[model samples]
Target: MTQELIRATIETLEMVTVSSLFSVLLGLPLGVLLVLSRPQGLRPRPALYRALDAIINVFRSLPFLVLMIMVFPLSRLITGRATGTTATIVPLAVAAIPFVARIMEQSLLEVDGGVLEAGLASGAKISQLVWTVLIPEALPALVNGVTITVINIIGNSAMAGAIGGGGLGDLAVRYGLYRREPVMLYTSVAVIIVLVQLVQWLGGYLERRLRRDGKVTASA
Candidate 1:
């Protein structure tokens, strides 16, 4: 039982890590494009902005469970199976991309307008401004956004188990619910809670450190 729980825990971590990596990779660029293509932006494009915005909204509107089922075929196509941790990552990543994108868009929007103006005045190209000024200035907020996205992903990963995507969630359903072992259920729940708490603490620490460093940089 102990070994079983540990293995399930590791599976959960792996799924979360892989899905988060892909989500950030895809979502971050979409988010940057979203901001840049908005009205009054560095490269405003009303048509493109509206199109992207609508697509994001459509994905975000779907419940995770529905999205997972809807994407099962694609998941199978990608992974050759749709009932394990690796295959589960496909739907998880799909659901998460729009979420991360919105979070990033919100965080980037929070950067001071004056800072962007200064970058422009200094003759910074759009790429340079985004890489240096925008991202750096928004680091603390972006960290917080990542923390939120991670927590959300963790929850969604558990739901993935309902379709045979194994993890602590699978353990809970199989042993705890099916076999009527309350201990197994509670243990899985406790493990998830602990993981979330740890991530939250780590995110807070990083955000604070970035803020302090930013202040020091400004003072210098």
Candidate 2:
């Protein structure tokens, strides 16, 4: 049981971490594009914005369970198999991309409009404005958004396990549900809760640090 628990924990962490990283890598740029291409943005293109918006909405609307099944073929192509912790990263990342993109959009949008204007007025290029003003101002919000995404991924990873993705969820389904081992089920649930709480705490800590640093920078 201990070995099983350890293996499940490791798998769950790997799935969540890798998926979250890739999601951020892809989603941050996508979110930025969504924002910049929107009406009255850095480079307004109503058609492009609408297209991106629609695509993100479509993916976001799909339930993760359905999305997981839908992506099996792609996952197989990417990982050479559709089942396992590594292969699970494909579906998980696909689901998380739009999820994180929406969060990133909201976070970036929360930045003060005045700051963006100042950057523009100062002859800052769009990229410069984003890197220097928009992102810095939105850093705290972005951190919070990432925190939320990570927690969501943790939950999703478990669900992935339900379909043989392999994690705590797999253990729960295999032993707890299939073999009638209630203890394993309960233990898995507890572990997930603990992991979430720790993530939340760490996120809070980082946000506070960023806020404090921002204040210090401003004061100086």
Candidate 3:
């Protein structure tokens, strides 16, 4: 039981890590574009902003379980399977894209406009302005947003096991629930609680450190 639990925990970690990577890599650009194209943004385009907004809304509105079912075909097509730790990453990442995008958009929106305007006045191109001013100014907030996304993704990943998407969820369902093993169930729950607590603490520490360093840099 211990060995199996350890294996399940590793699978959970793998799913979370890879999905978080994909979600962040793709979502960050969509988020940046959202900020750039908002009605009163660096380059306002209501039509584009609305379209992006709708797309993100549709994804975010769907419950993760439903989204998992909806994404099964895509997962099969991409990974040639939809029931294992590796294959489950497809839907997990897909479901997280919009979530990460919206979080990142919010983070970027919180950046001070003065920095962006100063960049623009200095003849910075849109790309340069985003790279130099918006992202830098928003880095601390962005990290917090990412921390939130990761925590949510971990929960979603566990839930994915309802569909045989392997992880601690699979362990809980198969051995704990199905086999009538109350101890297994309790252990699984305990491990999940521990993982969440650890992530929360680590994320808060990093965010605080980043903010402190940012303040020091500014003061210097």
Off by over 4 Å in 1: 213-220
Candidate numbers, best lDDT first, in rank order: 2, 1, 3
Encode model 1's per-residue lDDT on 90-153: one tens digit a residue. Answer: 9999999999999999999989989999999999999999998988888888889899989999
Instruction: Summing lDDT over every window of 10 consecutive residues in candidate 1, give the lowest-scoring window.
Output: 211-220
lDDT of 1: 0.91
lDDT of 3: 0.89
The C-alpha RMSD of each candidate to the native structure, in angstroms, is: 2.0, 2.0, 2.0
Per-candidate TM-scores read 0.96, 0.95, 0.95
The sequence of per-residue lDDT tens digits that candidate 3 reaches over residues 143-202 is: 898888888988998899867888888888887777989888888878888888888888
1 versus 3: better lDDT goes to: 1
RMSD of 3: 2.0
Estimate every model's Cα lDDT from 0 to 1: 0.91, 0.91, 0.89
| 1 versus 3: better TM-score goes to | 1
